[model samples]
Target: MPAPPPHSAGIPASRRAQIGAGLSDSLGVGLGIFPLGIALGVLVVQAGLPWWVSPALAIGVFAGSVELLLVGMLAAATPLVTIAVTVLAVNFRHVFYALSFPITRVRPGLPRAYSVYAMVDEAYATYALMPAEKLSSARMVTGQLAMQLYWVGGGLLGVWVAGALPAPIEGFEFALVALFIVMTLDALRSKREVPSALLAGLAAAVALIAFPQQALLAALIMFTAGLALRYAVTRGAAHA
Candidate 1:
């Protein structure tokens, strides 16, 4: 008899469909991540660290924007306490993302944990686009896994490209800023989000001018609090 079939082939048609959708949805996500990953890899080398650091951050931290900031800090030889605080401030938004994202499809234990760990902005945006009826636990997890692979793979490729270059290229470090700009524009497609985005931008500008020493942390705190208060007031007004 032939050897046992591979696992993917044995999955149900519906499950297969779900997996395919997940992979397909990740294409646009990969477009954004790949360049950013390349920038990160180049930045890693520019910072005078080993090539391994880029992929290591992509795999270990799995955060794009924050990892960019970390690269700068590592280069400056910044203190660990400041780095810790900055990381917490930047990543604190994930707490809110977790609040609304549906993870019921993920089975318990490590699988479920990985699903949560993989909940980057791209995954969140894709999940929000799908109707409840169209989503399956298998599909959701598969799509997230695919996106993570794209990001990790992109970082590794960037590392390779950086190594191949004759000398470190200047200005590639700005890719992180460009990536965030693109993400913000994509997110602002909804009219309802425009106000919040503007508010956050205002907060960032203020922090940049008034609190340059701790700009990112200050901007994030202001944005978070301002948005929370706006939502609460809106809800209260609606009920009244």
Candidate 2:
């Protein structure tokens, strides 16, 4: 049998427009995510997981960080309930992302579903940077589709590359730590966030001193509660 054609000349004109828009919009983000996806694919294989898990998580879960952590948990035979809770806690921020996301701008049905499914951080950032007039269903959906393609394809390629490795690779776990550090530094750059950063540092210190074995989760809970309480007190004092 012959291989398929290189181009989408056989596709309809309207569909082609969607494809073109998606490809163009995805260019900047695709460059960044493609390598990360490949790294994730490598991580999965290094974690002793089957290669297909990478694409499965990318296509199904669509969360790079959670998926990377999950591959390790799964390899360790973590319980389903524990995994579910961790996923919820880690991705709870997406609920807030959905509030301001341009999901409504896309046409309803499959395109809309695709928009929601592909609503990653990069997609949200892309939408934010795009001109209001350029926002359209085809552009939005196709952009997401292109990104998924890069991720899924890179994951498959990573698995193949991992299979060729002579021995187990080291240093993959540092990716998660590095990402969190970058994000923390980014969050701390704003003047208004300085107080919150200080509070977080205090919370981390307390959690570490108190719950050494569960410092991360304890610190997150303590920090969130402290922030909430502080907000409530400030509001009450202003009203009084």
lDDT of 1 by residue, 154-197 (tens): 77788888889998788877777776788799889989989989
Q: For residues 122-203, write the lDDT of model 2, one tens digit per residue.
A: 8898886677677888888888888888888888888888889998688876776787788789988897788788888999
Residue pairs with clashing backbones, model 2: none
Top TM-score hit: 2
Computed on alpha carbons, the lDDT of every model, listed in order, comes to 0.82, 0.82
The lowest-lDDT stretch of 10 consecutive residues in candidate 1 is 4-13
Candidate 2: regions farther than 4 A off? 1-15, 202-216, 237-240
Q: What is the lDDT of candidate 2?
A: 0.82
